[model samples]
Target chain A: MKGMTIIVKTISSWVKLLIFLFGIYIVLFGHLTPGGGFAGGVIIASSYVLLMLAFGREFVEKNLSLTASSRLDCVGALMFVAIALVGMFYGAASFFWNFIHQQYLADRATEFKLVSAGIIPLCNIAIGLKVGASLFLVIFALSVFCNDFRCKGSARELM
Target chain B: MSDIPLVLPAFVCIPLVAAFLLPILGSFGRKGRVVATALANLAALSLLAMSIASTNQFSVYNVGRWSIPLGINMVLDGFSALFLITVNLVSSAALLFSVRYMEQYTAKPKYLSLFMLMVAGMNGVVLTGDLFNLFVFLEVASIASYALVGFGCDDEQLEASFKYMVLGEVGSMFILLAIGLVYGATGMLNMAYISKAIQNNPTNVVLCFALALFIAGFGLKAALVPFHAWLPDAHSSAPAPISAMLSGILIKVLGVYALVRTIFSIFGISTTVGTLLVVLGVVNMVTGAFLAIGQGDLKRLLAYSSISQVGYIFLGIGLGGALLAAGASPVWASLAILGGLFHLLNHAVSKSLLFLTSGSVEMAAGTRQLDQLGGLAEKLPLTRASCAVASASIVGIPPFGGFWSKLILVIAAIGAGVYWAAALIVAVSVCTLIMYLKVHRYVFLGELSETRQQIKESRGSMAVAMICLACLCVFLGLVFLAPALRAELLEPAAKVLCDGVGYADKIMEFSKDMIVCAD
Candidate 1:
């Protein structure tokens, strides 16, 4: 499929970065805010989705290839597991133990800070990465059928 | 034993990690499939090991070091341990079988990944101590199975998947609505806390409504008679190994196990619900058996048999519950529950073996219809033998796993003074025998069809998986004869159910350590 109109392309280009940054903010500050990995990840994925719509699939593929996103999805999930494993190994702690909370980060002053909440924020980042990549892949895979949908127009669009 | 608690989360975590990584690994060309297979096998094997090692061990792991009733926890009691063993054992065998069976299909890695996710979900369902988390895990297993059911992308597969998905989602909706009502009534999502709340105020109308919803929801999942429309299509349409997984253990874990846990442990079993289960069990037994005798499709017959067998398990459990509600001797109640749980384990092994044999037949003969396939005893010796073994077991022939369990059910019924139930058990066994005889006569003993002359038996991993489960079907009856093994493997599980709402106290006691650790 060809790219959308120049105006749509230009506008999406400028707005995509803001959406990406906001998603990162949501992920990083997830421990203290309403938006955590899941919400933030969807937001980030939407930015890429917007890029796909405005600049076309080829452009988005060039920027973030399917293989890379797929790899990132695995890496993010592995990172979460690693954090939990590390917690287990370091202290003989239970699964998902908050090592940071029991140690240096215990002070009340650090409770609401970005660097606080032990491994929770780290977990949020990992989950955000995985969810974003997964959503993108789903969107990308679905979009591969766009040609069929286009040929059949509104009739097959419901499929 | 102390380390067992720490290992509990690994059951859920390892599978999740493997599932996540499989797709990326699969992208690495020819070597990727091998890598995915090795990784999945390792994950499955380790889970099997842990479940076995943890047979007698009991503990609960608190998430994020949060105390129970606050943060989510994973429990490893007798009941969950038995389920863990069955799930992981079947999973490992199915994964082994899939390595060969799935080669005929494309996207092997995606298949393995989804398989791992399903394992993770079932493990989570078996282990989680919180209500909402159980729901979450149940959905995980359900969605993965839904996808796997339609994995072939054939018209029939897609249609079957849609049917299964719609019904499954409706079941899930009932469960979620029940959870919401439960939360509203008790103001808790943790199962133990909810149990504690219900025990303190045992007369809430909303909780009773929630109990009704739970039965309907989990019953739909278990595919009890009235709600069993989706099983035959979905089971028969999916790939063979997956059909084995879905029909063998998935239904048990997602349906019967969940239903049993909620009914007995969470809501606390009473005579009313007990009688309800007994009635449902009898109806499903009669209906499922009659339906199975009519099916020409091998997998469809096994699916109906699954419903029928599940009815037996429910009957035993329900009789136990009724006896308990009547304040009868604890011995009779325990014996009934034991009979039920033993049947559950027996059926899991035999049914999966049956499905795998069906897969073998399908793989070799290129057809599942009993009318089209014949004389597999000559062409596919291994499959025929294993099929015979599993068939004998399912028919409750003596010395096999199914017979001992069925005998226990009869004895339990007689001991409970429920003579009619005992007679029903014997009658069902006879019907089950006739069905299997038909299977043996038509599929294995008759003359081979002309077109199927060139058919070949499934070799290597598929044969190995079938052989292993068939051996289990033959030898599992020893658990009844061996007192020590029974005490270690099955007794603890039966005890948990027998304790009823007292599970709340036991879990709370285990959580005390976590609370101390947290401080």
Candidate 2:
């Protein structure tokens, strides 16, 4: 029974890892596609939420504390603002001023990529971190506060 | 790039960068608070110096030196300069008030940081020459405000903040969708470029859809009658300085500033859009006033009153647009615009003053309930005096800033043959006066409550901030009588709007000149 439980847990964790990776892909490709930082971050958070539901709050908390997540959210938001300010240094009039260096096309005529296209991608990443952390903290806080049960024994066993 | 326009961008950058750093440093306790205060003060001083320097000159900073169509820009026109002054001035005052007032809250550094970020956001929105950048900054300010509103993390605060966040985010989404559509149609995001595109095409259906989206989005931010559900809760829930910031500056910068820029500079006001604004304005004025009268909570009442005051500014601008479109005298149109802009400034001062005073009262008497608190005006003389000035100004009493602005608006409305709008303005002013009177009577004039008899005066910084704003409230009225000052600032800004489609030509000429010089 113990071996069976361990196998199930491992499979679930792998599934969550895949979902998290997919979310990262969404955030990175946000500028090119329909999904952006906000959407991707929420996806990442949802993956964590899925893990927490399957394993338990203790597993998530042990991995990522609510306080730490909130701090990350703040840091992410700050980084986004900082990236916006970089335009001023470059003598680009105001915030979010894009300055593309070069562009290349590959795979298909429709598929094109730029090497240095200002701060859109940076903004996407910053927003991704913010959204992911904020959503994670919000969910984690709600669960921890509302749930009567507390984790016991080893942190891993809490899962 | 050589001239650098250092002061203008610094006004936004300083506070924004400080906001980011404040939380990390705030982990150090008292030292963090001191650092935050000093940084905020420095930013405010920079903004003041920049605002004073840019009074007569209109400057535009081309981001990345990529010219008009290719890069985002920051325009420091007289209108933007005036708002920049208002934002920084009020923020400075609020920060001064918070220096002592925020002591009751545990995380002072974090609070200060968020406050600065909010200021940066408002300043950015006002200065940005790109439509999408405006949206981005609007979100930056708004998200900070949402977090600040729930800073206390109490049940009421959480609920209010959640409601505010949901409504505000929806509004933001609408704005984004509008931007996407505009980009799709015009293939440009810069205001100047978009204006040129609209002038080239002039499609009614697309313009209508865009206008509707703008009205919905900005109206929600402005807390106009139809979209004011979350404001009362959010405003009342926030700490006093933040409450003042939101009611005073945030709505004006994000909502009114954006709306006016889009209509006047981008689309050039049409008859239908003008009429829609007027109708919305009148409805907000009447509804906000009526609702405010029934409120018992001091902050909640101020929140509703903010709605009413915002209505006046909108009505003035809307009337200006209507008259301009109808081929009325340019003088009357300009007068209407001036009134609207001046009222926006006045509201920022008096409403913020009111909120700060309310904070003082809440700090002293430990309650914001009108019925429960009375006659401690003697005990809290500074608070009483400041509240009186703010109340008088907001209610449109003469020799106060609000009165002159309203008078100009009414006279302009009458001149433009919008007699109905003029009448409504007067009616709403009366309603405003009555509500303020109730506030005065319940909170300041009646028999002193024994529970509040020992109420002490608000601390040093709060008192100083309130008094300074009160003084400005009196001094601002003198601007109307001074023709030269009025011509230099208000008239020029109004003319920028009255110029209408001519804006495209001006921008093109300006950019061409810059490019020629660069070459």
Q: Clashing residue pairs in candidate 1, if any?
A: none
lDDT by residue (B308-383, candidate 1, tens digit) is 9999989999999999988999898899999999999999889989988888888888888888877878898999
Error of 2 at B327 (Å): 1.0
Over 4 Å off, model 2: A1-159, B1-4
Model 2 sits at a Cα RMSD from the real structure of 5.2
Fnat per candidate:
0.86, 0.34
lDDT of 2 by residue, B111-162 (tens): 8877888888898998888889899889989999999999877779989999
RMSD of each: 2.6, 5.2
How good is the docking of model 2, by CAPRI class? Answer: acceptable
Which candidate leads the pack in lDDT? 1
TM-score of 2: 0.85
Off by over 4 Å in 1: A146-159, B513-519
What is candidate 1's CAPRI-style docking category based on DockQ?
A: medium
Clashes of 1: 0
The DockQ score of candidate 2 comes to 0.23
